[model samples]
Target chain A: DQQVKQNSPSLSVQEGRISILNCDYTNSMFDYFLWYKKYPAEGPTFLISISSIKDKNEDGRFTVFLNKSAKHLSLHIVPSQPGDSAVYFCAASARGAGKSTFGDGTTLTVKP
Target chain B: DTAVSQTPKYLVTQMGNDKSIKCEQNLGHDTMYWYKQDSKKFLKIMFSYNNKELIINETVPNRFSPKSPDKAHLNLHINSLELGDSAVYFCASSQPDRDGGYTFGSGTRLTVV
Candidate 1:
């Protein structure tokens, strides 16, 4: 069973526009959520994360919103750039579980 | 220096052959994990080790074995590989609490013909 799901397989957006990626989870025990960006032939890199206690967290141009009631989270990149094009993975982990469950990933392409 | 590194970035071997992927981390993390990214692009956790002791073993095949000689090193050995076993395997390290996300290796892509 896929505990975490990224329904969108791919997304495209124009440069300098807003890019939003969505993810949903079924396991209510997951208290921490993370986003990772991966490029071709490279491992995924940590992007942003939010705790279930908070509704939103922001870092520079990137922001993450968590709706605990809906079991959904989203990543928003304002004024997206071409360099932002990559596969974004949504991961969720229960506290003290020591392991995270990852989604299938959504490929985002920022067109210049 | 790379925090987490895996050897043999690409491997192509015939079916039924045994292969191993070596992983090492210089970050001094206490916990390490192995993840498999299959053709469908799903990253599944295969195993996890904490301080050279096994902590988590997912529903992976028995042919897949993980060995951790030390907290900084975790290796994966697959015996009698099958065609469906081809995938990109990633090794990652993190603190025992995992409050911060994991640091991942570049990944090793294995193709079994």
Candidate 2:
């Protein structure tokens, strides 16, 4: 069973516009959530994350909001740039699990 | 220097042949993991090791074996490779307790002809 799910397979947004990516999880035990961005051939790089205790976390132009009650999370990039186009994955990890479960990933295309 | 590195970026071999993928991490992280990205682009965890100790083994085939010589390295060996084994394999390291997230290798693309 997939504990983490990114329902949208792809997304497109104009440059300088807001881009939002959504993710949902089924496991209530997951306490930490992370977002990673991956290019065509390279591996995924960490983007942003939020703890179960926190509702929102921001870093520069990227922000992550988590809702524990809904078992959902989202990544928001304000004024999306063309360089932001890539596959975004949402991963969730539970306490003492020692490993994180990843979603199928959503490909984001920022048109310039 | 690369935090996590995997050798043989691309491997193409005939079915029934045996091949191995080597991975090493310069980072002194205590946890290492192997993940496979299939044609569908779903990254699935194959195995996870903590300080050379096997911690998590998914429902992967028995033909696939993972060896951790130390905390800094994790290698994957496949016996009698099948056509279905073709995919990109990624090596990742993380400090689970620190919540620092994971660092992944560029990935090794394997194609079984």
Candidate with top TM-score is 1
Taking chain A of candidate 1, what TM-score results? 0.99
Q: Give the alpha carbon lDDT tens digit for every residue of B15-84 in model 1.
A: 9999999999999899999999999999999999999999999999999999999999999999999999
lDDT of 1 at A53: 88
As for candidate 1, its clashing pairs are none
- Chain B TM-score for each model? 0.98, 0.98
- Interface RMSD for model 2 amounts to 0.9
* Pairs of residues at least 3 apart in sequence or in different chains that clash in candidate 2: none
DockQ of each: 0.83, 0.81
Error of 2 at B68 (Å): 1.1
What are the per-residue Cα lDDT tens digits for candidate 2 across A1-112? 8899999999999999999999999999999999999998899999998999999999999999999999999999998999999999999998888888999999999999
Total backbone clashes of candidate 1, pairs 3 or more residues apart or in separate chains = 0
Query: Which 10 consecutive positions of candidate 2 chain B have the poorest summed lDDT?
Result: B93-102
> Alpha carbon lDDT of residue A108, candidate 2?
100
Off by over 4 Å in 2: none
Error of 1 at A66 (Å): 0.3
